[model samples]
Every structure is written in structure tokens, then in C-alpha cells.
Target: MAAAPDSPLYLGLDFSTQQLKAAAIDGNLRVVHQDSVQFDCELPEFRTQGGVHIQEDKLTVTSPVLMWVKALDLLLDKMKRAGFDFSRVRALSGSGQQHGAVFWRRGASQTLNQLHPDQSLHQLLQGSFSVADSPVWMDSSSTQQCHDLQAAVGGALKLAEITGSRAYERFTGNQIAKLCQSRTEVYRDTERISLISSFAASLFLGGYAAIDFSDGSGMNLLDIRTRSWSKVCLEATAPHLDCLLGSPLPSSSVQGPVSSYFVRRHGFSESCAVLSFTGDNPASLAGMRLQQGDIAVSLGTSDTVFLWIQQPRPALEGHIFCNPVDRQAYMALLCFKNGSLTRERIRNECAGGSWETFSAALRDTPLGNNGNVGFYFDTVEITPSAVGVYRFDSEDSEVSSLSPQVEVRALVEGQFLSRRLHAERLGYSIIPGTRVLATGGASSNKEILQVLSDVFNAPVYTIDLSNSTCLGSAYRALHGLAAESGASFFDVVKNAPEPQLVATPHPAAQQVYDHMLERYARLEDSVLRKSCT
Candidate 1:
């Protein structure tokens, strides 16, 4: 059935590592209904005693494609429950985690239902290659592959220039290279390779796969400026890898219709168009209404800080990533792998399970935490840092050092100062004149926000939406559809509610932070020199 001409709706999906969330909005961008379903990625366990490792079973890191089908079913069921007409949904799209690869054979003529119904698809592919258990973006066992690619491509800087990012252990290119080198037989049987975003789109549409620019940019195979797959990168990294990695389609392109299986199982209209998929981070930026000069800092399990720049800037040496969100915009990002997890760990083990207790203890310490003594908090540092991992130690070598409470204050102070230093190196001006938008779990913490505002000397604001990534994906889907039809993107976003609160920097606190930032930089430099050697 075709969608109603006047009341066409759009659907946006936020596909995370653990679940899939779907949101539907009408032609006017008013949300009709939203629903989500949890799924598990069955990851294998390995034990290491001393330096020797024992694989108890074949490490199966599996997230069934069936989970997505189930999620879509649930979504449609919820929409129906909410009194929505299935035929009203005209366009559908999604955002997924970047860098995961999914594989399928070209000659398999069976529809998704026939293949997936009895779980025979798993059995069929298992005979040829590792069928299920696609390695997700979080799998970081490819460190050796990263080093090899860096060496093959000359060096890390050269690789960064060509790939628009430093060689990361979790990138798709490295993962494919590792498989080719270690499991040559399996690599020979590989037919087509695609990122999770493209694969999910293909599953829904029942055909060949193609990813959008946002997801492709994360694979390290795309030339950022060209917005296309790099033949040079393919040859240098994995020559035998399938070209079915496919050309990157624009985010607005209509991939195809929901498969017969999907329509039959979930009762979706046959006319629903599956829009191209994007990465979650870019979706979050879109959701936050990030434009040029607007920075979005997400403090999740890991902290990611990024901004949408009008033009592509030269890649920074440290931990900078330049990912293209669309043809006209590029997102410059930094990822702190152990961001909130580190803070939570400190709260639990060091501060006795309460952040309030920790904050209170930190506050009891004086400004500058006494004199010149400083703390280094390196749980994980992402930016233009010479160092990748975090380590904490005192800056001053004096016998009469600060007390433990003062030491904790210095640690928190240094963490914020470090972020400020990194922001500046990436061409971001950390001054009171700019407004910084904070999101994720950390934004809810008043103490954290206050510290961040003071360190950057900027007003920190949090939007009304808590799950900005999901909201951003939905907003992007709506905007993309609207733009295709010559409608206004700003008009849709402007009507949304303003931030709940804004925290301004304290002048006296800013003075203390300014001096602390300099000393922190020097300490960071010394640590980097030691680590690099």
C-alpha cells in the first residue's frame, strides 16, 4: 500500500551495540511514536594465565541479525498500538555504530525469512566461513594489524593523512587485513563485505549493500574529501577484500523498499522507503543541532568531544578523527575510551560509592590544591595527545606534599584542564565567549558541569533531551526527507524546547584554572616523552 499523500511519515532508527530504537514522525516532524528492543551480541570468553592464553571455545562474538527483525516488528506493533496507520510511513532510515563489517554471499537467492527462519543460515555459512559473530567496533584485538598497516603505509602520520584518522585497532580495514593474514582460507571464501549500517539496510531491503558517507568515513577506507572508497587504501591494506564494500551512497538516497519478509511479518506498507544509514556519533551531532563552531561533548561509557567544521582541517597528530557527516560538513572528533567509566571507578573504589561524597571531599580542598602540586588523571586521554593511555602521578616532588583530599581535588582539576588544552590544540578556542553544549550521562552531574565550565571558562549548557544520539538520528531522518522535498531544516529544529539549565563559569575559579592549565600541559609533555621512548 502507498503512503497517504498528505500525511506521509518518516522513521529513524538508532542501532546501538546492545539494542535497536525506532522513532516515527509525521510530515511536520512531530513524533508519532517510538519503541525499542534489546539484543545481545554473544561475545566469546578467553582466559589468560601468566602470558599464555587459552581459548576455551571458539570465541563467538555474535549479535543475531534476527534481533533487528524483532526490533522492527516490535516497533510496528507499538505504532499500531498508538493508533498509527502503517501506510502513513513513507520514508525509513537509521544510524548505527561505525566500523563493524557484515558479510553475505552474492549467489544466495533465498529471501531473508527462508534463510533466517530455522537458523539454517548460520549452519549454511558456518561450513564456508565464520558466518555469524561479526566483529563489532569494540573488538580491539587488531593492534598488530594496525601496526602492520602503519608500517606498510609508511608511518602513522602518513596513514592519518591518507585515511583521515590514525590507524586504530578497531577500524574495519585493519580487521579485514588481520583476517586475510591469519585466516587465508576464510578470506578466500569471502564474497561481499559491508559495515553494520549498510548491512542492516541491505537486510531490510533484501539486496546488495551500500553505506552512507558518515558510516563509510569511519571504516578508514574512504578518502574524506572525495567521499568515496580509496583504491589506494584498499590495495595498501586488504587487496583481496571484496569491492562489494560498495560505493558510499548519500544519506538522503532511498536504498529500496522493506523486504517482503519484513512487510509480511511486521505489517509495514510495501511503499516504505529505506533511507541510507549513518554513524551514531554524526547522528548525535545532528540531533544536537550542531553547526559550525558549535561543540558537542558526549560523556558516555567513553567521552567523545567533537564539532562540525565547514571545511576539512588538517588531521591533528594526537587522537583527532575527521569524519564526513555529509558532503558539506565534516565532524572533527576526539574519543576518551575510559571517560565516564574512569570517573565511576574513582567514585566506587576511591570515593566509597557516592559521587556526592567524592565531590564534597574534593570541595574541602583549597584552590590550586595548596601550592604547585598537581595530579595527572589518565584513565584514557583522547585528543592530540602524544600518549594514548592514562596514568596519574604528582607533579611536585616536595616532601610536604598535599593531603589525600587535596590530591583528589587536584586530580579532578587536572582532568578538566587537560581537556581544555586538547580543545585548544584542535583549533577550538576555550574562552568565556563561546558556549559549550554538554550531553550524555556526565552532563547530569552538577559538579562535573561546573568543573568543565570553569576549566574552559565557557558557559556549559545541556539540552532538554537526554538521549541526544537517538533524537539526533530521528531529526536527521526528518531533515533529510524535508530537504529532498525543499522544506526548511531550521524550522523543524527551532520549535524544540530550549535547554533546561545553563551553568556559567565562576570568575575566581577561571583564574585558578588558567594557571593550572599551563602546569598540566608541561606535565603532559613530560609523560608523552617518557612513553614514546
Candidate 2:
């Protein structure tokens, strides 16, 4: 007999950089209810800007641990007010901003187990973290730690071969090393270290949660092929690192039922299972159900372009993370740190802080901005490893001046052109007829996406929801449960809804960016070589 139509629902949460969002999906995989709490606006008590605090020195970027805990409390409360029935939520899994590590105090496990329904998580867990604030992914202060780690593990290539990417300063391993070196006593008192995703799941699990393989791939410690911690890499970072971090779990596997704390507090059943949480990008892949032919561009706080692949290859410019849906497959990614912030800055300078004017300027200026290409990096960029604004003429030569309208178009075109260039090197094919699927906050902007389509010379697409990470987490929960019930993941997603084509490449404009890509690549090479990255 077929299962009941009113089957238990699955809950997915995304602890993203700027906000905490939750989504509920029913047995049919349709989003039932969803809500979000923006950290900067909703939780001003944390005094965080853009969901982070950048130290005055400007290298350190962190968010208060208590603020995240409090966000959970507020999010859940808001969800309840929005008519989310916790009792119907049969399974929960989530995605979080990758690389950020949370240091649990020695007694944190005890605190988790003893959570009281009458109290908030932030209230009960005030002293649960060894570190009050966690070094987030935006932090690039671990430059020394990255070098030390690469040296300890032979070299950059060897380490990248083991992990997915090179020793990125924002990676958890380097961040942990920095913490240990900066505050030895706090590192000594830490009982467990959790990635941002697992840390959030541990709250519902009522104990330390294991890191999933996909998220683990972002850390410079996990051997991606084996899906386990690399001994040499671990030894290089910290002492007995394995003791602090539990074995990495496969993303498809279920962690366990929700703890009695949640059972008592929110009416969750003892039978409600919690799946292992992974990084937001990986989770977004699962949510988008990315296919081999499609390229996914996430335009959030950080702009990233990723595609699905079967084989893993070593590349310095981008990343190859284990697929969240399939343990065997891999996903290639190129992350640009100056995503929304850069766009916002350009808008402020050129359009007087109005996205409408920015869009109008983009449309007003002809595609390619008359052969002028601009690379805007308001912060340290991950792709080219460069910083600051750069403008170049038609011949890939540096130019001094441009109009605000021209600058706006150039910035948009330059961003997508760089992605196209690096992605090809990372083994992503960007042919004339390719399709680009867009998601995240900025993906909804048709004007911005039009530039993407024009530059890539491909049609752009968007799913029903812009925030696919949480929805994908929800889908993943149901998919895992369905897998246990004898249904395949591919079948579940394939039978689900298809993304709508949002924008098609302009025929004449496509030719312009197609030709400009070469110019952009030349300038990109010169800039990267000069930076000595």
C-alpha cells in the first residue's frame, strides 16, 4: 500500500552568513512553510554588521557564538508564530556557512543534554563555548597558519591533493591553528570542535555532531578521496585533533533522532531523525539537484560558481567538494569573496545606493561597456587572489577613467567573465550554448542575471525559491528517509519540479562578451601573475 498522504514533514535549516533560515517540506517535497531571521536587522543585540564583526585591525572576522544560539531561539519562536508545527517535523537536517569552527567548552555536552524547555538555548548555553566568538569564513587572518599547515603536510600541491583546496586562510584547519597559537589555554579547554553546520545540528542532537564529508572537504584536514581525516594534515594543525573532531560522516546517512531536549521543548517526536549537516554550497547543490550540463552560480554574500562532476581533480584556482547527494561524485567550485558587497559598493558609488538605478545603468550601457572591463574587489578576492578596483581598456591595457554607468556595466560583466575564465581552467566547459542556473539573494535581480547570461553566452535559470540551500536540506532529509524506505535519490529529485528559464542570452550581446572573455582572461593572467599567487 502507498504511504499516507499526510506523512510526516521534514525540516531544513540554513545557518548562512547573514541569516538563519528554516524551511519545511511535506511528503510531496513542496515547501510548506518557511521563515528567516536576518542577523544584522533582527538580532541587533549581537552588534554584528553583515552578520559579522571585523576587528579594527581588519583581518579578523567573527560572529558571536551566543548570537547564533540566540538566533536559533528567535528563529524557532518566529517559526512557531508563523504556524510551523514542530510535532509534524519528522526529520531535520541543515547547511551552514562553511569553514567556520565552533569551540565547545568541556562541559558543553552536559549542557546540551540538560536543556530545559522553559529556557532559551542562548540562556542555558551562555558559557557552553570555549570561544565566545567563532572565526568565520570571511576571516583571512590565518595567513601564517596556512603556510605552516602546507609546510607540515609536505607542500601546497600534496595538501591540495589530499584535501579539496589549497591551504585557504579561511579554512577550518588554519583557523583552528590560529586559535591554538593565539589562545593556547582556550584551545586546551575545548572538548570538541564543530564546523558551523555540525555545530548547529549538535544543538538539536543534544551533543557533539559529526562533520559530514561534503563540509569536511572545505577543511584542509580531510582526505577527500577517502572521506576521512588525514593524519599528517591533522598532526600539522593541532595535537590530537581527531579527539576534538569526530569521524566525518557521509552526507546521506542519518545522524540520529532528535534529543529529548527538543522532544520536550518543541514537541518533536523521539522518532524524528536528524541527518548529518554539510556546508551551504554542498547543500545548495543537492537542493538545486544540479545536473552535469548545468552551471550553478550562487550570488550571496560570496559569489560562487559550481558544477557537478564525477571525477575529482586537483586545481589551485577552484575547489572540488564531495557531492552532498552522492558520496561518489564531486562538485567543482570557484568562490569570489567580493560578491554582494562589491555589487553594493558599485551601486552606492554609481547609482546612489539604488539597485534600480544600477539595473537601469546596466541596461542603458551597451553590453561590454564599449570594450571596457572592470574588476572590482572591495575585499580580498578568492578567485584571482587580488584586491582593489581595476579598469582596463579594450586591448586589456589598464585605463584610468570611466563613467558611473560604464563602471556599473563593466563590474557586472567583469565578474561573470572572470568566473567563465577560471571555471574553464577548473574543467568547467563554458560553450556558447551552455545553461547557467542562478540562485541566492542576487540571483533574483534580472538586470544582474542578464549580464551573467550576456557574458556567459548562455541562458540563465532560477528555481522556484532563491534560497535553495535550506530547501535542498529539506529535500535531502526526505531523500535520505526515502532512501531508507527503498526510494532512490535520483528518482526523487528527477520527479520533482524543474527550474524555470529566467533569462536567455542576447544574440548580439553574447558575441560581445564571448570576444571580451579573451581580453578579460589576458588581464586576469597579468593581474594574478603580478600578485604572485
Candidate 3:
């Protein structure tokens, strides 16, 4: 039977670094409504810049827990005022910025279960967190903890083999260790430790939501193979850590129905299922419908490249997470800190601050930029730990300068080439029918995408939607409904709009980039070696 026009809806929410966003989709998988609350602009009382507070040491970064609660209250109120029928929402799932930790107070679960419909969530739950300022993903103050953790598990390689990642300073386990060591009282008072993804789902679940396998892989504590917490890692980090973290759940697991507080206050149906939420990147993998042979390239403030893998080769440089969609599969991620901002800086310096002028330069220069490759790192780069600009000529000799047009082409080409290099280092390769799914601000520019296509030697594709993560969460919600009945993630989203083919590799692209890649690798190594010396 065909569904009615006013059929059940699924809601996906994203608790990002700077904002909280939501997208609702109907049974047909078309977006019905979208909304967001920007923390910096909407909540000035918090006085947060970029929705976070960087401590005096500049290494500790945090977001006020109550601020997120207040933003949710405000977002729901706005939706209610807009006459969004919450009763029609059959299920909900979401994504949160990865690696951020939230510490629940001893009696926080009680406070959550007893939420009053007449009161705002922020008002009732202001004291629910043992740590008022939760350490976010931007924090890098847990270096000591990261080292300690890596040592506890033998070494970085051993840890990565177990947890799907090395002990990154921003990872939740290290952050927890830092708290336990630095703030002993706070750690003692913390009843439960939830990653940001599970923490948001907890609000709707009326208790605690188990961290999904996909997001739990970000912490250096999960045994990704078993999809459970590692006892060695837990004992090394803190006392009774497993009790505080609870058990890990599958990403599509139906947590339960929505809380009574939401049903009474916002008219949500009592039967509305809440699915386990995952990390923003994993959610995006679902949204983009990335297949086994596809690579997803996000060119936002920080460029990120991710892909689905049947067998993961965990490394220290990039991250490997349990695939959110396929229980038996995994995903790999490579981050480059210098993305749009670096492009913008180059555009301003060489093209008078005009993307139009910048693109014109790209069209003006030939492919491979006459074998003039440049590594431009405005700030420190994450993938290859390097800084400053280093230009190399066709002969692989370091050069000091190039023409403005050449500089422009070199910058764009270098960025994509580096992505390909590192992605391959993580065991990613271009097979027949491989597609590059591109998103983020820079993806809209065809000229830039042309370079991306040429470097990877694959057809480039782009999605029309601006928020893939939120949409992915919505898709996850619907998948949760069908998962128990044995529907695959692809089966659930078969009707999703196909990504538009933005660019295709030039016939000669393989020949040109094949040689350029070798030279680029040598130059990058030289730069890194020089930086050390």
C-alpha cells in the first residue's frame, strides 16, 4: 500500500562545534523541514566565540554544558512556534562533533527522568553535569594523557590495532584521564561519561544512551574488533571506567521511545523511537551514501577525506572507525588542517581576494602546473607535520618563487595530491568505478574540483544538500526502523538523490599525476626532514 502524504517523519540532529542543527525527512526520504541555532549569535550571554572557550593556557578548549541544553530548548521552542508537528516524528537519531566528552553528575539520570514539561531543559538540568565546561574536540591539553595511554597499550601501533586510532589528545579517553589526574574531585563525582553523540541522545531517552560502536572507536578505549571497551585501556585510564561508560551499542540500535518530558512538553508521540547516534563524520558517510569504492572529500574549514573499507589498515596518521552503516565494515579518515582557510589566504595573496580571479588563474594554468609543485602550509598541517611554504621545480629542486598563476595552480594541486598520498598510505586506492564524493564550501567551485578529479583520476560527485551529517542522522533513524527486519543501509536510502557528477578525470590525468606524485612525495619528505633538523 502507498503511504499517505502526511506519513511518519524522522528527525536528525547535529550537535556541531558552533551550532545545533536539525533536519526532518518524510517516509519518501525528502527533507521536509530544517532548523538550527547558532550559539555565538543566539546565546550572547554565554560570551563564547565559535561556541567555545579557550582557556588561558590556549590548549584547553571547552563548551558550556548548559549552553547546549539552552540551545536545544530554544530550537524546540522555535520549531513548536513554527507549527512543526512533533507528533508525526516517528523516530530520531543524530550526530555530534567527535571526541568531545560530557561528564554526568551523580544524580543526573534522575534529573533527566524527572524533567518537568512546564520547565525548560536548561533550567532543570543546569546542575546535571559534574563538569560545567565539557572538554571539546578542539582541546589539545591532554598530551600527557595521550602518551600515558599509548604506553599503557604497548605502543601507538598496538593501540591503533585495538581502538581504530592512536591516542589522540582530543580523544575522550585521554580527556577523561586528564580530568581524573587533574581534577580528582570532578572525576569522583562523575556518575557517567558520555561522548557528545550519546549525551545528546540521552536527553530524549530519559536516561543514558549507550555510545555507538562507530563513535566509540574515536576513544582510545574501545576494542573495535569486539565493538566493546578494552579492559586494559579502561583500567589504565581510570577506576571503574566500564561502569561509568556502560556498554557500547550498534549505531542503528533503537534506544527506546522518547522521554515523557518531550511527549508532554512538545507533543511528541510516546512511540517515537530514539536510535543510537554516532559521530558527525560517520553520519556523513551515511548521508553521502559512500560505497566500497568511493572516497568522500570534505573541503570545509579543515579538509577531511574518508572512505569505506571492508578491511581496515589502522595507522597512526589517520583514523579508522567502525562503519556506521555496515556492521562488518570499517571507515578511514584523513584530516588536513589547512583547507579553505589556506585556499582563501592564497586567493587573497595571489588573486586579490576573489575566488573568481583565483579560478581564472586555475583555468589559465595547464594541468600539473608545468611540474611546479608547492607545499603551502599557512599554519601547521595535521597530516604531514610541516609548516611554511616550500616550492619545488620539475627537477625536484627546492625553489623560492613562482608566478602568481603558477602559485595558484600549485597550491590547489598540492592540496589534492597530498590527500591522495596520505589516503593511499592508509590503504585506500582507486579501483574501477571509483567515485570521489566532494562536499564542503570549496566543492562548489568546478575548477577546484577539476584538479581534485585529475589528481585522483576519478569522476567527482557532489550532493546538493548543505548539511550531510544531519541528513545522514535522519537516514540512520529510518534505517533503525528497518534494521531489525534485516534491511541494509543502502536499501533504506535507495531513493536518495544521486550525487551530481561535477568533474571527470582528463584522459591524460593518469600519466601526468603518476609521475608528479613520486616527486611530490620526495619533496614532502625532504621538507619534513628539514623541519626536524
TM-score against truth, every candidate: 0.80, 0.83, 0.94
lDDT tens digits, residues 461-494, model 3? 9875478899999999999999999999999999
TM-score of 2: 0.83
Compared with the true structure, what per-residue lDDT tens digits does model 1 show for residues 103-123?
Answer: 554454244434443333233
Cα misplacement distance, residue 6 of candidate 2 (Å): 4.9
Worst 10 residues of 3 by lDDT: 1-10
Model 1 vs truth, CA RMSD: 5.6
Query: Which of the two candidates, 1 or 2, achieves a greater TM-score against the reference?
Result: 2
lDDT for model 3 comes to 0.93
Which of the two candidates, 2 or 3, achieves a greater lDDT against the reference?
3
Name the better of 1 and 3 by TM-score.
3
Alpha-carbon lDDT of model 1? 0.64
**Candidate models: Cα lDDT each:** 0.64, 0.86, 0.93
Question: Top model by TM-score, which number?
Answer: 3
In terms of lDDT, which candidate is stronger, 1 or 3?
Answer: 3
